[model samples]
Target: MARFLLRRLVTSVVVLFGLGVVTFLMTQVLPGDPARAAAGRNATAEQVAAAASRLGLDRPLWDQFAAYFGRLFQGDLGTSVVTRRPVLDDIAQALPSSVELVLAAMLINVAIAVPLGVYAAHRRGRFADVAARVIVLLGAAVPVFWLGLVLQLVFADRLGMLPLTGQLGFGREVPEITGMTSVDALLSGDLPAFGDAVSHLVLPALTLAAAFIAVVARTVRSSMITVLDSDYVTLARATGASERRVVIRHGLRNALVPVSTIIGMQLGWMLGSTVLVESVFGRTGIGAYAVTAVLQNDLYAVIGTVLVIGVVFVLVNIVVDLVQLWLNPRLRQPARGAAPAPAASLAPGAAAEAGPAVKEGAVS
Candidate 1:
């Protein structure tokens, strides 16, 4: 386990380095003068030149790259071209909202997918299974923005069942603890504020979850079907184990090994999907932050956002690897060091000497 963790740590560092390099190159190719963006449209050439110097943009590419990484090592993500504040500060402020949103979407996805998939598998080939699959297909096929608009139209504008946009009502307040409105509200014993936050969250979370729920459910359904047909499941059934017990205890548990991997892989998907969802819902999350940064040609902010997402993706996959090791005992076995020497290739003298011992041990 220690070795496994170390390997993952090394791989994560490499992944982050590659992400940084690629993001830097991509930003360089973007069509706009970041110095001008930072200095403002009406600024004189002198002001733009000063801004470029201050931002290290006037340095050689290699020098600037080195400087970026140097500041990165010290936890500074440089200044945002648009905000004129530290990019790290902007990310810190927005990241928690995105985290909360993604987590909520993931929770909704797992809660619905697991049970629905299990039931669908149990009723495979029946009308229930067909209906479940159809629903999943529709969920996956729907565009996130269109779905968000439809949800907002029906649930917010028409029915007035939920808030139209934002994390909370205009004047509603919750103590800023975690930056997650609901969590912060609960921490402050503000149940009404918590309720309001959740009401605002429902539509966006649902829209974000719709894209992934089908993927997860389909994975679970397929895995559950395979597990159900395995020898152990058949043996359990033959032993008169209840269908629920056989399915839940024997099938679903094992099926979750693959499902966990899929769920972890979806972390990136969830984060990416938040871009569209946040825009439609008017949430000020990292996704929205990213969109704003791109529009304003904020080089530092874009780089910072990509690095953060890549780091998160790596961390989540590591956790998933650990979870898989826990769920599947076979994965916990120590890796084999080397192949044993073939008996046929052994020295004749050693083989003769070992043959009697082997025969005696077998007889005993």
Candidate 2:
């Protein structure tokens, strides 16, 4: 376990380093002088030069990168040229909404996918399996923006149900200590606030989760098909174990590694889709924050926010890796460490000395 964690920690660090370099290069390649833009057209060359110097923008590229990274370690994302507020502060305010959205969407995905996947795998090559595949294809093919618009049209415009825009409405205030309105409402014992929050959340959550549902279901179905054919699964059935027990305990348990990998990868998809989903619903979150930052040409804000996203992306995958390791310890352990004969002790010459009892037991 320690070795596995250490390995993942190193990998995460390397990934973050690469992300920082890429983000820095992207900022460098953008058109126009960032300092001049920040200072406005009326500002003299002297003012622009001063602004650039203050921002470390006038420094050598390597020195600038070093300085930016050094500040990042101390949790200073630098002041946004556009907002004149620390980018970290802005992210702190907006991050919760994105977190809340993604977390809720994942729950929705799991709730729908697990059962559907299991049923489809069990009924492989039949109607249910084909339907599951079709669902997956549609989910993958459909654009998130288009889906969000259609959802808004059908649910908000046509039916006049569900909130069309914003995370909350008039006179519904919950202490956003946790940054999630629903949780805040629950914490404050405001039932109506919670209800309103859910009503607002339903459409966006469904739209975001729709893509993941099919992906997760298809992955699960595929994993189950492979696992169900394994020797232990067949052995479980031969021993008169209940179908449910055999399926869950043996088949699904061993499939955790692949399932978790898919789930972790889906986190990236969820983050990318948030830009459209939040924009469509007019939600104040990191995705919307990112868009605003870009529009204003806020260099520091964009870099800071994207770096934060990269950190989150790395961390979530690390968590998934840990979960997979726990689900299957053999993943970390040496292959030969797993023994079918736990009770039988072998002598130095056990193979040559083995007789009827050992042979019969092994055969059985």
Candidate 3:
């Protein structure tokens, strides 16, 4: 297990390094000079040259790339060409909003998907299953920005149940504790602020969660269907175990391996997709910052944001691999060293094999 973990960690590092290289090259190759963008249209040739020199843009491209990587290795993300603020500081300031939004979306996805998937699997070939499938299709088909706008219209404009935009009500200051509005409001002992934050978060979170819920539900339903037909499930049924216990404890546990992988992948997608949702909802987050950086041609900020997201993707995959190994013991064991099967695979008194043997064990 230790060796497996070490190998995964090393692979993650290599992947991150490659991602960094790609980010650097892509940012460098993008048209339009950051110095010119920062300097504005009215600037003269000398002014542009000075700005370029100051930003090390006048240096050879390779030298600039080397310097950027050197600074990155030293934990310096460089100063933003537009804002002149440290890239790391800007990221730190913006990260919480993105993290909070993604987490809320994830929670909403799990809450809706798990139950819908379980019910769909339980009601296979019935109307419930058909309805669940239809919902998943619709969710997957709709664009997130369109969904966000529709939600804003229905819940905010028409129903008037929640605020249209912003993290809090105008002029109502919520103390920043953890940078997560909901968490910070709760930590500050302000129930009203907390309620407001959660209310504001609902539309965007739902918009983001909709697509992910569709993915997770389909994965869970498929895995559950496969698990439900296995031999152990038949044994549980024969042992007179309650249907609920058999489904929840036996079927669901075994089904979660694939479901977990889907969820992890969705989490990484949520991070990237939040950009569109954040823009539509007027939320201040890394997504919003990234958009601004792209508009202004701020190469440093763009590269830094991409690098952060790439690292997150690599880390999430590693975690999913570890979870998969933990859930399926067959994956963790040495394939060549496994003990031989018994001569009689089943008891003489036992009924005929009711189903195929499950290759993977239950997921914790």
TM-score of each: 0.89, 0.90, 0.89
| Per-residue accuracy of model 3 over 1-364 as CA lDDT, tens digit each | 9899899888888887788788778757888777786567679899899888877888998998887788778878877877889888998899899999999999999999988899999999999999998998799899989888998999999999988988888877778878999999999999998999999999999999998888889888888898788766776677566889778877887788888888888878888887898999999999999999988778778888888877788888889998988776667766675564632232221223322322222221
Candidate 3 clash pair list: none
Q: Which residue pairs does candidate 2 place in steric collision?
A: none
lDDT of 1 by residue, 1-364 (tens): 8988899899988988888788778657878887888888999999999989987889999998898778878988768877889998999999899989999999999999999999999999999999999998899999999999999999999999998899998898987899898999999999999999999999999999999999999999999999888755665565566888788887888889999999999987798778899999999899999999988778778888888888888889999999999988767676677765444332222344345554565588
RMSD of 1: 7.9
**lDDT digits (tens) for residues 1-364 of candidate 2:** 7887898899999998898788778768977677886787689999999989888898898999899778878989778877778999999988888888988898888888877888899899999789878886787689888998998899899998988988888767888779988888889999999999988998888889988888888888889998888655654565566888766766677655688888887886687678889999999999999999888878778888888888988998999888887776557665585665632332222233334544576789
TM-score of 1: 0.89
Number of the top lDDT candidate: 1
Q: What TM-score does candidate 2 get on C-alpha atoms? A: 0.90
Distance from true location, Cα of 34 in model 2, Å? 1.7
Q: Which ten residues in a row have the lowest lDDT in candidate 1?
A: 344-353
Q: Provide the global lDDT of candidate 2 against the true structure.
A: 0.81
In candidate 2, stretches whose alpha carbon ends up further than 4 angstroms from where it belongs are 335-364
